[model samples]
Target chain A: MKKVYINSIGSISAQKTFENASFLETIADYNDTVLPAIDPVYKDYIPPAAARRMAKGIKMGVVASKIALAEANLENVDAVITGTGMGCVVDSEKFVSAIIDNNEEYLTPTSFIQSTHNTVGGQIALGLGCNGYNFTYVHASISFESALLDAKMQLETEEAENILVGGVDELGAHTVKIHRLINHIKPEAVTSKTVLNSKTSGAVFSEGANFFVLSNLRAAQTYAELLDVKMFNTLEIRTLSKAVLTFLQVNGLFISDVDLIILGNNGDVAYDTYYHELTDKVFAETPQATYKQLSGEFHTASSFGLWMASKIMKSQSVPEAAQLNTIQTSEVNTILLYNQYRGENHSLTLLRHVEV
Target chain B: MSELREELKEKIIEQLNLEDVAVADIADDDSLFGDGLGLDSIDALELIVMLDKDYGIKLSDPKEGRKIFESIGVMADYIAEHRTK
Candidate 1:
């Protein structure tokens, strides 16, 4: 089987992640119910004509892919895979609202065309003129992980040399309001420093796009070897630890061998306990870290967590802002990332530092 | 004629969410795409809808928009000749 490595990564999140020099140096502490990405100059990456009709999610995904490709020094990839939970929600809301408000008369096609879940992947392929393979997954929280797994499988099977895989979510006003109605968003805005300790039922909702250029060939800029990625559609809290152990075992790793563990604790009082189960029990000694506090909670926000893991592996330093526990490792080599949403769609990713 | 062109620019800005651009920034004969205003395929779709909704000119294919939306001058001319509403 061929090996897989992350050649490059790009993220546009609530924090200033697009400019490579900054690493959450100053975060937008939100007190509102929904947080939007700290957008880059879209015109700098996307042409005006092509960007005219793109929804926020599509813009982020396409711009992020461009940044990742530019970093990888490639113009096109063999495949484009994307994950979006709500899937072009800004357009979806626009179309649906138009249908209702206009009473189904003279409705335009722009929103309908942009509302498709695969539009981002399609637009990326259109932009790059790459027609090899395109796929989009909309499986709620695990959508991004599903895209990652698909890209990894293709790389391992030698079906594609380089693939662009990404996850994106955009906040819609109506969607945010409805989620707040159900307590899926925090009752009030919480700062990044206070998100985990908010002790709220809902999370601090946010949006972002994280993209990676994954290839079978390792290079100088490669972040880490994607040892293995696994996802579960439904995993109970009791089964979570065992499932993680099995995932590590398949990768020939033990709980103690993990130099760092990144958890997706999104400040949901109801579901943060899932992380507590492992952090307090099975992997107490492993240095624990989390990113949702910095990035905010979205269905595909775990993609940002993966980006953070890749950065930590390459830099061999974990940002003090992300540290979840005091346990420190002298040499950072192996990193494990665990994420789930509202107690479902759990994922565990194992990454190993390359010697070169 | 000039009012129609100005209206078109405002409609385009509003419909396409050109949040940073203003109607005054657009010249009547300036290109709607590429160098002039940097509109793209997505913007073309928005213009297509404007043609249909406001002027009652329905374009089945997006390619039809390339000529009609070349500029505010061309768009207003096409809409003047083709508008049913």
Candidate 2:
């Protein structure tokens, strides 16, 4: 089997991730229950003509993918795989609202066309004129993990040399209102310093697009070698520990072998117990880090977790802001990323240091 | 005729998110698609909806929009003649 490496990464998140020169150095202070990503100037990466029709999700996806491809120094890739849980939800809301308000008489196809979950992948393919394999996964929180897994399989089997894979989601006002009504979002704003300690029942909703180029051929831009990625639609809280153990054991890793563990603790008092079980028990001694507080909570927030892992490996330094524990490592190498959404769609992604 | 043409330009700019373009930027006879204003098929769909919603002129077949939406002047003329609202 061929080794797959994260050759390049481009992220537009709640923080200033798109610049590549900084990684959560100066954080964006958000005290709102619903946070929005710090958007990049779309015109820099996308032409105005093409960007005019793109909604937030598409714009973010296109720009992030372009950044990834550019960093990898490639104009095109063999495949484009995207995972979006809510799809172009902003467009979806627009289309649905238009249909209702206009009584289905005057309805534009732009929003409807852009509303599809695969629109990002499709648009990327269109922008690059890549007619090769293109697929989009829409599995709730594991959506991004699904895309990464597919890319990994193809790279491992040598089915494709390089692949552009991404997880993108845009905020929808209607969706946020509904999730808020159901208490899926925090009732009040919680600062990053207080998000974990907020003891809230729901997370701070947010959106982002994180894209990476995965190739069997490692490059200087390679962040780390993606060892394995696994997703579970449903895993009992009790068996979660064993699942992580088995995942690491299969990869020839142990609890101590992991230099760092990046977690997806979104500050939901209810579901966070799942992570607390691992961090408070099994991996208690390991250096733990949290990111959902920084990126805010979205379906594919795990991709943000992966992004954090990749950055830490590349720089060999974990941002002081993201660490959940003060126990720092001398040399950062192996990383285990664990993320779950509202006690479901659990994903474990293992990445290791690649000696270039 | 000129008033409607100007109004159409303003509306088109607003509806299509042509933030960089203004009402005066689009001449009366400028092509709205493919090289002039550089609109695409999707923009045509949006304009079709705008016609039905704002002017009550429904063009069920989007392909038929090619003639009416050839330019701001053409669209204004068509809407001026057929507008029910």
Candidate 3:
């Protein structure tokens, strides 16, 4: 089996972390219930002719992937895989609303064409003229992790050497309104300092795109070695502890071996307890960190968390803003990322510092 | 003819969600795609529906739309010639 390494990563989130030089230097500090990504000047990466038809999610994904490829020093990849929970939702909402408001008349096809879940992956392929394998996953929160697992499997089996994999979600006004109605978004704005203690049932919703180039060969610019990735469709709260231990055991590691543990605590009182369970029980002694408060909560927000983890392992520095516990490690090496959404679709990713 | 062209520009902006661009920015003779207004395949579809809904010109194939939607002037002329409504 071939070893998989994250060669490069690009992310556009609520925080200013898209550029390689910056690492959450200045946070957005949103007090609103719904937060949107700090968009990059996409024209710098995508030509207006090609970008005119792209939905916000597709544009972000494509631009981020371009940035990742540029950083990896590669023009094309063997495969492109993407994950999006509410895929091309701005277009979807537009199409659906037009159908309703116009009584099915004067309904344009652009919105409908861009509304597909696989549009981002297809667009990436079109942009690169890459006819290799392309896939998109839309299984809610685990969507991005599933894409990563697929890419890892392909790399391990030697099916493809370099793959572009990413996760993206764009906030739509209508979707936000409905989610707010259902109490999925916070009722009021909460500052980053107070998000964890909001004690609310929902999270501060946000959206972003995180793209990475994974290759079987380690290079000088490689971020980290992707040791293992696992996802669970359903994990009972009681069995979660045992599950984590078994996962680590299979990976030939223990609780103490993990230098830093990244947790996805979105400040939802209902789901934050899951993080507490592991933080208080299994990983109490490990240096802990979380990023949702910085990036806000989205279906694919865990991708941002993984991006942060890769940065920490590569730079050996955990931003003070992401610290969840004071147990500091002398040197950052092995890091484990755990994330879930609404008490379901849990994922565990292990990455190790690769010395070039 | 000028009114029809202006109306077409409005429909295109509203349909394509060109929220950043205004109707006045679209010159009648300027290209609707590529360098002029920066439309693409998705915008072609939106214009196709406009042709069908507002002008009663049903073009089943998108390939046929390329020649018809070259510019706002071309679009208005095509609708004026074939519009059943």
Candidate 4:
């Protein structure tokens, strides 16, 4: 019944995105198996006592949400929805190791309390003193898309005006070690300049927090209009284009209508072809961009993709850092973001420039 | 007794991640929580584990910890009297 606008945005990724002025002007390039986000000063946003107990993921979520709220010029919101794949892995690892190290004796509850997937949403609600609907989605790579869909439904139905939605994941030492053992992370470090060409079996893993303020009412802060969002748990490479076409058609669009297509190509030789196929044939003429080289690969890394798309729509400029193809459109309007993790959890998110 | 108080202060600083507050900043009689060092319920639980694991002094009730952890002076005295390890 109502149009949904991305009123405010916040991002804390491998690059310095927490500050709104810069949009991938300088990318934080890392050549590591597991990358961590360049952090903002936690003390300025959170009190010392509260921050001390917060794991990396929670702090990122809280700070990113605050930035979104501040940018929207709002004190509180109607709902807070968050998504995470690993869900506070730093604290989960601590709690599990503490249990084993102490022989299940004299264990404290702090890490255990913070280890849940919904803790970020709960903590944000507590911080804002907003006890409205709080939800968290943990659907692997499509986690962020799921949260966005939930918020979009409410906003479109006019059930809620302003909703805070975010996606966050923190890298854990033990988790990285296990993924490395399983070859989920690339064998060699891949730099941003050479990530897509690495021909690697695994990806360079990373973590980030990206948030958005969604409302039915558009204001000067509106970044873009959230046209549509869809997620698929399993997708074959051959059927990928068909799915994209159907999604676009349902949204009253066609392949030629898309101005830019943001892909999630993380240099994994086995699964990247799913995205490559789309670029090679179906959406070849569309200007393309990729972000995993800058954000690294995580379950919720697609939120970083959404953040980039929103920035492009609002600023009306596509940074050279995110360019995937040499083809640039004269007038960029509609952006199609497609992401999948390890050949599963495929997500399609469409964002368009808010028509003035 | 003064040595024990200083040791308690250092332990509190390290355990609670009080990076801005140093040992010398906390006086012996200063309260450990609520308008003093500003510790909360979570910090109290951390101190309880410290008592059991570090000093072999276990208090089954967390309410008892309120009295024992009132100040650095009180905490040091309790540990000195009850420590078994």
Candidate 5:
């Protein structure tokens, strides 16, 4: 099997991460129950006529994918895979609301067409004229990992040389309101610095797009080698440690072999114990970092964690803002990311530094 | 007649999400589809909905839309003649 390498990354998160040169140097602190992704100049990446019909999710996904393709120095890829929890949700809401208001009369097709889950992948393919394999995974918390796994398998068997994979979700007004009613969103506003300390029952909901180009051939701009990815439908807290160890062992790694651990701690008091189960016992000595506090929690939020892991592996330093513990590392050669949502859809992704 | 033409221009711009366009940019005789205004099939569907909802004109034959929607003057004249509302 061929080894898969992460050649480049693009992210549009709550922070100003669209510019790849800087690594979380400036943080946008937010004190809100829900955080919206910071917007980029859409015209720069897309034409106005083409962008006119796009929702926020589509714009972010298209721009982020463009950034990744540019960094990989490719005009197009062999495949495009995308994952999203809610696809173009704003348009979905608009279309449904219009139906109710008009009594099922005089409906237009734009909203209905753009609201499909595969629209992002389709739009990216249309923009590049790439007619190769295109797929979208709607699995809840592990959506991004599922997309990554698909890309990894194709690259391993040499079925594809390069693939563009991404995860994206945009906040919708009606969706946010309903989640708040069900206590899935934080009841009170929490600032970035206070997310981990929020001690609340729910997480601060947010939206973002994180994309990466994976290839079998390493290049000068390669970020990290994607070692492995594993997902679980459900994992009990008691067996969490065993699962971690078994995952590492399968990859020919021990707990100590991990140089840094990037965890998905979204400050949901009820479920964060899953992460605590590992940090408290299995990997106490390992340097640790967390990203949901900065990116905010979404179904595909784990994609942001992978992006951070790739960045740390390339820079060999951890930003103080993302540090989960005071422990520092001399070299970040290998990193593991663990993420879950509402105590389910657990995923583990391992990345390693590429030897030039 | 002029009032109806202006309303049609505004409606087309708003309905199609022509964010970069202005009311003055559209001339009465300018083509709505190919080279003049640069709209495509989707915009034709939106305009069909607009004609039904706003002017109470239901187009039974889609081929007729090609001629009626050729320009702003054509659309306004068709709507003025067939509108029941």
Candidate 6:
């Protein structure tokens, strides 16, 4: 019934993107397998008392939501929807370890209380003092897309005017060890500039939180209009291109209509072929870009992709740090973002430039 | 008994993750819940677990926690009287 626009964006990534004024002007290149999100002064956004018990995931999520809300110039929203693949993994690890270390005798309540998947959403609502609809999706890589879809439905149906949606995941020591054992993380370090073409077997794992304020009511701060979003549990490499074309067509767009394509190519030789299906064939001529090099490969890292798309649309320039190809576009009106994790949970999101 | 009070303050600060607070900040009779130390119900549960784990003092009734955790002085007194370890 109504159109949805990305009114504001906030991101806490491996790169310095928390401040809205600059967009990748100075990229942080790292030669590491696990890129932790750059820290913001958490005390600046949250009081020391409230932040004392929070793990990094919760802090990042809370601060990112606050940035988005402030950018949107709203004190409260009707709903808060968050998508986190490993919800509060640090706290969960702490709670579980305590269970073992103390023989289940002296488990504290703080870690247990904060370990739930919806804790970020609950904390945000709690901080805002807003008793409203809050939901969290933990469907691996498509988690962010799921939250976006839910928020979009409510906004389009006029159920909510403004909604705060975000995706966050924090690195857990044990989880990273397990992933390393399974070869889910890269064997060796790769710099940010070289991660995409290293042709590695596994991704450079990372953690981040990216949030946005989505609203049906457009304002001067609107970044882009959310056109459509599609997700799949499993996609055959052969059918990936067809899915992209179909998604674009459904949104009344064609190959030429898409001004740029943002791909989640995490340099995993085993799975990056999913993005190659479109990049090499269907959308080969389209200006192409990738972000996993800069953001690393977390489940909801696609939220960072959405953040990049919004900034590109608003600023009308694609940062060279994230550019995957030499192709250039004079005007970036429509952007298609495709992302997946280890050949599963594929998501396609369409965003169009909003003239404000 | 004064030694117990100092130990209790250290433990409370460490257990509740009161990073900004020092041992001196928590006066012996200062309130631990509302405006004094600004702890809420969650911190109360942490204190309960701390008492059970370190002092071997298990509190069964939550209402009893209101009086017992009123301050570092009260918590140390309760633990000194009831602690089995």
Q: Which stretches of candidate 2 lie over 4 Å from their true place?
A: B60-64
TM-score of 6: 0.96
Candidate 1 chain A, run of 10 with poorest lDDT: A20-29
Model 5: chain A TM-score against the true structure: 0.99
Q: Model 5 chain A: which ten-residue window has the lowest total lDDT?
A: A191-200
DockQ of each candidate, alpha-carbon based: 0.44, 0.81, 0.49, 0.65, 0.87, 0.85
Worst 10 residues of 6 chain A by lDDT: A191-200
Q: Could you tell me which residue pairs clash in candidate 4?
A: none
Model 5: per-residue lDDT, tens digit, B25-49?
A: 9999999999999999999988999
Candidate 5 residue pairs in clash (backbone atoms < 3 Å): none
Instruction: Write one digit per residue (lDDT tens) for candidate 2, span A228-297.
Output: 9998989999999999999999999999999999999988899999999999999999999999889999
True contacts kept of each: 0.57, 0.86, 0.62, 0.48, 0.86, 1.00
List where candidate 5 sits over 4 angstroms from the true fold.
Answer: none
**lDDT of candidates 1 onward, in order:** 0.90, 0.92, 0.90, 0.92, 0.94, 0.94
Candidate 5 lDDT score relative to the true structure:
0.94
Q: Which model is ahead, 4 or 5, in terms of DockQ? A: 5
User: For model 1, what TM-score is found for chain B?
Assistant: 0.92
Cα displacement (Å) at residue A102, model 4: 0.3
For residues A147-234, write the lDDT of model 3, one tens digit per residue: 9999999999999999999999999999999999999888878998789889889999988999999999999999999999999999
